[model samples]
Target: MENNEILLKPAMSFAVLKILPLIFLALLFLLLAWYLSPFFVFFSIGTLAAGWYRLLYIRKSIYLVTPEVVRISRGIFFKRTDMLEIYRVKDYVITQSFILQLLGLMNLTLKSTDAENPVIWMVGIPESDVIDTIRDYVQEARKHNRIYEIN
Candidate 1:
């Protein structure tokens, strides 16, 4: 296996849920467009396409924690990938809503010194051993990279 193997593929449920309101709006547009001219069909299609693109983008989101780096890949037709060296990782915070707590899911935000992408957000991760494993890997990577603070 690759050393940079994927550590977690987070659930898309959170992303889908987050966009439900927009999806409802899109549905409303479709209904309105149906009563309107056929030209509005194009508008409805555009709305639906945008909504699907959002869902697909969230679905493609992946969180990867290797010994040396943390990576997030997200997007639909246009893909984006962000990587933060583990040694640059300063801290991480895990947040959960009441519903998320009930569902045993949490969102993790990583803070790093990386200039371009200093903050990394990962949602729908199981709040258990995965967090610990990531922490351990960050520590190990810092050690391996000989990263230390003078103070």
Candidate 2:
């Protein structure tokens, strides 16, 4: 209800974090301006465009928990909102690629036990630690069978 009562965690963006190369390339282009090659301008523009997309993609990557379910929401192009009852969860998986592992990020997949539809996956979680946090929340929700409130 109140901002003070909510856990406002940091929103991590792979775009922002992974922009080191773009920044370097932009700088390199500027530094090598004397040469004035078309490639330099192209690279510089490309880097800026990428950085711009990433910046717009930024959001409050967060999952809010209540007494019933877990509500996870995030995205840049397609805003996602997942609401799953803790009891319906059949399996929980956490995966990290080589690049993600190096960057300390992970993807979380939640499988529900329902017959027709049963799988939900969230990508680019920005931090590997969210797996633990989400797992712990699931456990607690299961213990009490709580429902989540979605915004």
Candidate 3:
């Protein structure tokens, strides 16, 4: 069996999945404001604009999905990378708050056996299939002990 050690990150545009719900809630406020006195319009506009910025940020936060691992990298001044080995992974978890559930989005956590440490989270995975695919690959890595690349 090959050793599996790598990082997996959320797919690009995942950030959009997060900002969208806020936009909706903001819209709700805007509507309420319009009903009351139009003062809430600014809040709605600001939320929409921020959501659009998130969409653009989502355009940039790309992920590298490989056979043995997934890599998340972004930013020029504060570039960062996270790695998680498939073999080291212990289980999979999908979480969503009431708002996230309402938005049809979720956060996928790849939990390792390290009890003292926190699990790695891939936030804002919109599609259930995307989460499933990741779980499948992680399982496959465990099943065959797939070798992974760190890059």
**What TM-score against the true fold does each predicted structure earn?**
0.80, 0.52, 0.51
- Residue pairs with colliding backbones in model 1 are none
| 10 residues in a row with least lDDT, candidate 3 | 1-10
Q: Per-residue alpha-carbon lDDT of model 3 for 91-148, expressed as tens digits?
A: 6788888867776667777777545334766676564666556667766877786445
Worst 10 residues of 2 by lDDT: 2-11
Candidate number with the higher TM-score (1 or 3)? 1
Residue 65 CA error for candidate 1 (Å)? Answer: 0.6
Top candidate (TM-score): 1
Q: What lDDT, from 0 to 1, does candidate 1 have? A: 0.77
Off-target runs (Cα >4 Å) in candidate 2 are 1-15, 28-34, 55-59, 76-78, 95-107, 114-151
lDDT of 3 at 40: 85
* Clash numbers, per candidate: 0, 6, 6
TM-score of 3: 0.51
- Runs off by more than 4 Å, candidate 1: 1-6, 33-42
lDDT tens readout by residue for model 2, 11-106: 354556656677787878866764766567777877788877665554455656444565667676788777667566667788878877787776
